[model samples]
Target chain A: MEMEKLYRMHSDRVYSYIYLLVRHRECAEDLTQETFYKAYKGLEAFNKQASTATWLLKIARNVTYDYFRRKRVIKFFSFDKGHDLETNALSPESRYEQKEQLARMFATLSKLKKDYQEVLLLRKIQECSIQETAFILGWTEAKVKMKMTRALEALKKEFHKEGGHPNGTIKRI
Target chain B: MEPSKEFDELFEEMKEVERSEEAKRNTWLALKGRIATKRKRNIFPAFISLAIVAIATFLIITYSIPSETEQSAESLSNEEIIRAVLEREYNGPDKEHLRLMNDWMKFQSERNAKNQEEYDELLESKEYKDFMNYYQTTFGEYFTENMLTKAISTVMVFKYHYYLEDTDIEMHLENVEIKQEKDHPNIYRPIIEVSLTNSQGQKIFHTLREEFIFSKSEPGKIGSYNVAKGGGSIEFREKIENFNSYVGGNEDVRTPSFRKTISFDTLCFNGKIFENENTQKNIHGCTSDRKKINSILKIFDHLPIKEATEQESRKRAEALPQMDNYQIYLTNEVDKGTTFYTITLYEDGVLMFAPGLDLGILGDITTAPHAVIYEKVKLMLDEFSDN
Candidate 1:
């Protein structure tokens, strides 16, 4: 596929995945660019065994991990004192509540082990198939299923601690 | 049980968080530029080969041009002949050495450029803009132009340092209210509420009530606001039960190690100097001495020490048995608030300095003004020890 076309078709998904993992918008953008750059460079070697989306995502995952490795110690915050989390205007009250809950959920998700986070993000959040997740993560189907189960359980427990009931009811404190 | 339907809804909401059109265009442009650069780099080997051929041709031409003087020059000593040849062909270092130096310089330039790019990107972020907006909205009304700028800059420095080491924590501005002090009607108190949550589900609800004591002469001017006297308290809440105990008792948590320690001799604190127990002495100095001590204390106050990962703490424990020489101490009352620094310098040249245990793992003072502080302390100790 042409680089521009490939990017146009899948860049949003790829960017979103990376953004969720790194939780930094600018870094996500850079990593997305890096992912495409690598894909463009390695386009010839790409075996067509996986879909282009999967291939791009695999590259994205690797690029993000490489970034983490280079910055072995991830800095929690930059030195600029005026930093604040981005906020958008609320339309309906319910939408605002949902957004807040989602933010809380993601914050909990970040606490999970890297492997668990990767699997759940890819399979559940990004809506990648089990096979696609396994391929991206270099895990077998069985391992993906096994890890997914464990990841979900861990997430559920975290949710429960955050006032989320097992029956999917969330009580906001 | 399967994942909840609420999770599906949350995931759908997450999809909405995407790259904007401008971001997409920018990313594509950047990708294209990088690809073009990569293609250009691919031709570097060909250029190098061509250069080698050119050099060979030049050498052949030089060697072929024979003169009666050149013929006679061969009769000189081997070293003399080599010196002459080198002087004729080169003004300084050989081509190979120059090439290596050029490569090293290029590498350094590229790394610096990458760092600058990352910093620029960070400045352009929405979160940074929001932070600036918050400050401007809250303080802009009362601040003089210069005072506002200085206040924002000071706050930015604190925010930057705080966030750099605590990226896992999310900061939310809960509220910002401007009110008058109870007795002092003219004095404005901007009560800012900020909520912070870390990855471990621990939350800190902080209420910063700043007493914006404006000058009587310039009633609402920025310079009038006294920031030095403002203070706040943090209220901790754990979303997860026993989160503190988990973080505290569990030393196996994995934390990043950014600073690396190097060798240093001598140690100094305030007026006391210690090279060895017997060599320790008290020293007095001019006004600049106090300034220097204050600077060192400021750096120590911001040392990036965090709790070691459980695995790291274990590894350290195992290694401690082998580390026979290590010195740990607290500085004498640096101020009235009982503020002191804990410094652990090992025989193997590792130094771990921090203000207190709750702040996190003791970090190496290997970077920047901190490194400068270390050197100054060392020099002070050396001077006193010599005396």
Candidate 2:
């Protein structure tokens, strides 16, 4: 595909994946650019084996992981206070309840193992098909299915621990 | 088994997370520019490598052949053959010269290989990767990729002053907020809070929120949007305090205390302007233009004076090249209590105003205003030459 068309088709999914991984707007934006730049440079290496979106997301995932490795020391000491502040959607008073519930769920998700978080985000949140998730993650379709099952169970346990019912409603303890 | 409703709701919220339209546009522009530059740069290296190979081939051909005199005289050593050839071609050929040439070539080849390895490693380095990522995110469509890289040796903090139709504005990274849209799950908005200080010293602040929608699927592409301005306020002092506290405990933070203020009655411009210094010209006495002092003073007055963080001061000290014998002197009456301040002008046209007594304060006059001052000074000097 032409670079422009490729960018138009997949940039958002790529960017959102990076954002979910890094949880920083500036960092996510940077990683997204890096992913595309890498895609552009490595375009010759890209075979038609997987869809373009999966390839882009794979690059995005690697870029974000590279960032995490670089920032591991800083991350250990500092809680990312800026992550929750990134979303401007809940500024309205009416959406406060929903926003709080989402925040709680996100908090639970964030505490999960990195791989679990990745599996759930790709399978459930991004709503990627098992094959696409496998392609992007460089995993087998069977592994993605197994991981998704385990991730969903882990998320449910964490949510319940956080006073959330299995139905997804939050109960303030 | 079906995914629970709670998981679905959470996933639904995650689906709403996306790149703003403005961000998408900016990233596309940045990516396009980067790709173009990469193409151009790639071409140049190919040409360079080709030229290098051709030159190496020519050198090998020319240097490998033994001369008739050497062949007739005796079977000479490689060093002796080189010496004889040098002596015949030029005047002097010492044993040391052949050794030096061999050593230099060996050094050059080794250095070249080392440098190539380092460059390759740097391409894969985390710092370089982060730099590429940050460059696109921080500047976006506002700055070209090459502009950020022109001076790789120097640490430059770019402050963009955007001129709207009626209002002039400046935004720091601290004031920007990015969030998902509540009503539309697939959209994200980046709202920048702008604090405008009017002539009366009263501050009027407003939020410039993005109006365009962005889809979660293609978060990098920003759609068209008008800025919705809303009422807000900026607490400048509080922000400064917070910044100071953040960097306070670190020894690298050079928190210079305020020293006594100095007043100057006269200014002098000296050193090489075009080629060499014509003469030491006094701005107060040389120029017949009555507004000369005020014009110069206007530039000084508008300098962005602020307490320099330790990181900024250190970066400035390291990055700035050694200045030539350039000096701008300010003097006042002895009884009137005069102060002399030193201003460092960078090759890139950034001026750092460092007051006397080693005041921890550093004033930065960005390139635009610094250019204005430089032009004004040159014009004043040209007037002197005309006479």
Candidate that scores best on TM-score? 2
lDDT score at residue A124, model 2, on the 0-100 scale: 79
Top model by lDDT, which number? 1
Candidate 2: misplaced stretches above 4 Å? A73-94, A166-168, B1-6, B44-387
Which run of 10 residues does model 1 chain B get worst, by summed lDDT?
B258-267
The true-structure Cα RMSD of candidate 1 reads: 27.5
Over the stretch B35-111, how does candidate 1's per-residue lDDT look in tens digits? 54553333121212233334434544554454455543325432233233223221221333234334534543454
Highest DockQ: which candidate? Answer: 2
Model 2 Cα lDDT, one tens digit per residue, B48-151: 23333344345444554544533422344322322332222122122332343344344434544222344344334333333333323332222223322321
**Which tens-of-lDDT digit does each residue in A2-98 have in candidate 1?**
5667888999999988877677878889999989988876776688989999988999988988998898944221212232223455556655565
Error of 1 at A102 (Å): 1.0
